[model samples]
Target: MDLQYVNFFAVAVLAAVIGVTLIVVHLSQRKLRAELTQLREELALWQKAGLHAPRAVAAAEPDARPSQAQGAPMAPAPQPLSEEQIRERLQQAAGAGEAPERYRHVVTLADKGLAPEEIARVLQVSSAEAQQLVRLAEVGRKKS
Candidate 1:
């Protein structure tokens, strides 16, 4: 084949690949956006029904742990955490820029008297990290 023809073919192939990739990305983003919107709507419903925490978190109380350890069923429902309370906790979390936002949220929830497990569930963090943040918050409180 002529050099110019070979170059044209390669460019055409590259353009086709780019086009396919852009289409794939666009479709993936659309799917993700739809899923996110659905989740947000479900969250709004749950909030309206006064169910902020999961059933598992309801059984995470210090007094409730013993029953769970013995294979008892979880609590009927978690305490109703109002939207205003969540907003207040987030506002407190926003006050400190010394740590990452996730860490700050964890500490704020801990300070608000939420258990490590509850904080983990609310913030979508690992339980171990939430426990550490809670302990860190405790130490900070003691120092002040």
Candidate 2:
């Protein structure tokens, strides 16, 4: 092929590659936006319920301190829920089932002020999942 034809073919291929890359990026952005919106909605629900990690649990772990400087005034800790309250919350969150018993156990561990890591160890779940369950219990109690 002539040198001119070869150069033209290379440019055309480059353009096609760029077009496909743009399309992929556009689709990825749309998926990420949708996920972000869903997460925002969930966060709003939690906030409306006035949920946060229990204060007593935070105090028990030395590393769970607020990010604020030592001199800064910390936000007042939320009142800890009684074990009975925790069980009630777990029942509500878990719903009616033998499986809910597992969820109920989460609050039992949490009621003792166990950290998520300890809870994970007891429940054989990932620490992150244990944390989520703890938050779920918190949300359950705060709801209504």
Candidate 3:
């Protein structure tokens, strides 16, 4: 191909890539918005019903090892964790810096005593990510 033709092709390819990227981003935003709407509905229901925490949930077992892990000592599930216990678990899971605003929100929720799993659900992030955010938030808190 002529050098001029090659340059034109490259520019066209770049434009196509940018267009595809924009479409993908728009779709992702729409999906996230839908998730947010669903979360709001759930929150409203929870508020209207005056929901309370169950007596015991997995949050209590901070040190409890998974039953199926190799060579790990399996422990019985502990009783339900107190608000403080849950908050601590969430905070301990946090770290610092990648997404300060998001992590800050995670920390706030953790302080409100939401379990890591619950925070994960509401935020549409994985439980591991939620934990990490909490840890980051704690580290930031200590520094400031």
Best by lDDT: 2
In angstroms, the error of model 1 at 59 is 14
* RMSD (CA, Å), each prediction: 14.7, 10.7, 16.7
Worst 10 residues of 3 by lDDT: 49-58
1-144: candidate 3 lDDT, tens digit per residue? 799999999999999999999999999999999999977875664455454322234444533334345565634433554556656654554433234345656776788798788776555455777776666566557655
> Which pairs clash in model 3?
56-80, 93-135, 94-134, 94-135, 94-136, 95-135, 95-136, 96-136
- Model 1, 1-144: lDDT tens per residue? 799999999999999999999999999999999999977875675465455633445565545333556886654443444555544544565475444545556665666678887876765545666766676555555545
**Per-residue lDDT of model 2, residues 33-75, tens digit only:** 9999976875564455455333343345654444456564554
In candidate 2, where is summed lDDT lowest over 10 consecutive residues?
Answer: 49-58
Order by lDDT, highest first: 2, 1, 3
Q: Model 2's lDDT to the true fold?
A: 0.66
- What TM-score, to 2 decimals, does candidate 2 have? 0.40
Off by over 4 Å in 2: 52-144
Q: Which regions of candidate 1 fall more than 4 Å away from where they truly are?
A: 53-144
> What total of clashing residue pairs does each candidate reach?
0, 0, 8
